[model samples]
Target: MPEAYLWDRPDGGVPIAVAASGPSSSALAGEYADGVIAVEPDAKVLELFDEAGGGGKPRFGQVAICWGPDEADCRKRVLDQWRWSPLGWKVNAELPGPDSFAAATQFVREEDLVRTVPCGPDVDKHVEAFNKYVDAGFTHVAFVQVGGESQPDFLDWAERELLPRLRT
Candidate 1:
């Protein structure tokens, strides 16, 4: 095969994966790709992906998780950094600029963010958040912290507190 004409990857080649919003895209991923990077944490998507692919390879998931030592601070941080996330898929996908996203999410409340984003310090809450994807058939996970947290501290706390629970 010819060398990849575009895209960058480590070691000169990338394991291609599919970004799927639902069953249709997941089906395509299942058929031809290594795995699906799901945006929505829905078990049915994984089932469809596996079924379409005629059963397993690897299933991975990415979930936006915002947390801190303090729940209130975590909520505020989530609001400041990810308020636009609640704009829904259509607006989020079609919006061209940060201004559009900001304007679109102007009315969103912090409480509502809890529904879609894991925003708080409760260890169980965070564990449950990740478990939702894992239970849905994801073999791996992407813990994206959107709230501009101290990465080292977050990782430390997670390793000590979060990782243990998730492992079990």
Candidate 2:
């Protein structure tokens, strides 16, 4: 939708480093691997892929990596973070508004392009923006929950609205 940034890890909620060994690992891996659709950041993604035991061939759909604030920071702060290449698109963009989502959709679709949309702690504020992005032809919406306080709200809204819109 908007140029929202997202970070994709093999895992889900837990940071990448610990996610592999975290408790949620198995559960995270199991949920998406069957259909192999989209992957949000955190440790869960990896868990699902590995557990599926597909021998490197995931059972789900396609795997898309999200590069949001943390992803950007990793590319900047971490050493040699560019190693995450070889994935699909490298999404990075500021919130695109000022123009209606209608215009935004036309541009991406006409150009045959996809980009990330940046989101923060504000659920109501972000959701309104998110709806616009979906209207604009955004197929996926990844919420980078950088803080503990914001995680639940952002995710709840995503599941309720954003994710449903993307599926259709």
Candidate 3:
């Protein structure tokens, strides 16, 4: 059976990992995966993974960020672009299509979006929010910029303001 053995990689440079949510998945990753893409900033989950994994394999996480020059615009953009994310990744992944997602999130409010996504012009808030994942042991983070546009303003702010402080 395929499960009876592992296949050799062509070059061995590929870093294989699994998306782990809790203890059982983390244990499975410990046994077979090179790292884990954790869905939340939960320290206990990472602790369980570390304890079971023999050490800390690379841990990865994502942070949803919605930004504009002002707080109200950011909130509106977050509500429009990221409202569906409140249902979490499992739901997001399983959602049948865009219309399904739209129907599901049509009634979602700015308040709801702001609760989970970091939406604002404040650089410190963004830093503080992402630090939770870093504190939770994520070795790498995906900063998801959610807005209807390219948001050059957000990117510029990130490059000029966020990156410098994050490096330190």
Candidate 4:
């Protein structure tokens, strides 16, 4: 095999984060990577990572959220767009494509999505969802607003309501 090298290398190296959904991978991330990222607020992942020497390292998490004027519509939108989220990474990874995901998540209920994701215009619910990650030792938390053309509204609401509460 021929050797390959980078033509340009920066003075400051970039941080590497490993996305892990299971025990082994989480431990591996702790052992090798600069940080770990998980889709859910799973304390066990962090525990395992910390045990493997990832203590004090950045832990990033992501959650799905939907905010709108109507609570029912927001719930429906999250259910329609992100119902597949509760399937867990193993099942989500095995799916071949969007059609397969749709087929797999067809039976997912709105309440199921609500249990995991904060849906609607309630600032408290959104804050609670973000807090779950924070309480799980995650240093940084990000959210995915599941909808269309509502980014501006969401940002505004988050800035006015969510950010202040989380800061406190």
Decide which is better by TM-score, 2 or 3.
3
lDDT against the true structure, per candidate, is: 0.79, 0.36, 0.80, 0.88
True-vs-predicted CA distance for residue 7, candidate 3, Å: 19
Expressed as tens digits, the lDDT of each residue in 1-168 for candidate 1 is: 597587656885667888776667878988988878875677887888888882767777888888787778877888888887666554677799988887888889999888888866788887887888878888888888875546777888899999888778
Model 1 Cα displacement at 133 (Å)? 0.7
- Cand. 1 Cα-lDDT: 0.79
Q: Candidate 2, 165: how far from true, in Å?
A: 1.4
Q: What is the TM-score of each candidate against the true structure?
A: 0.83, 0.24, 0.80, 0.90
Ranking, lDDT, top scorer first? 4, 3, 1, 2
- Name every residue pair that clashes in candidate 1: none
Off by over 4 Å in 2: 1-56, 59-117, 120-143
User: What ordering of candidates by TM-score runs from best to worst?
Assistant: 4, 1, 3, 2
TM-score of 3: 0.80
Candidate 2 per-residue C-alpha lDDT over 94-160 given as tens digits, one digit per residue, 9 for 90 to 100: 3244343334333242112122233333334445544543443224444443334435654666677
Tell me which of candidates 1 and 2 scores higher on lDDT: 1
Task: Give the number of the best model, judged by TM-score.
Answer: 4
CA lDDT, candidate 3, residue 84 = 89
lDDT of 4 by residue, 34-96 (tens): 999999899999999999889999999998889887889988888877889888988997899
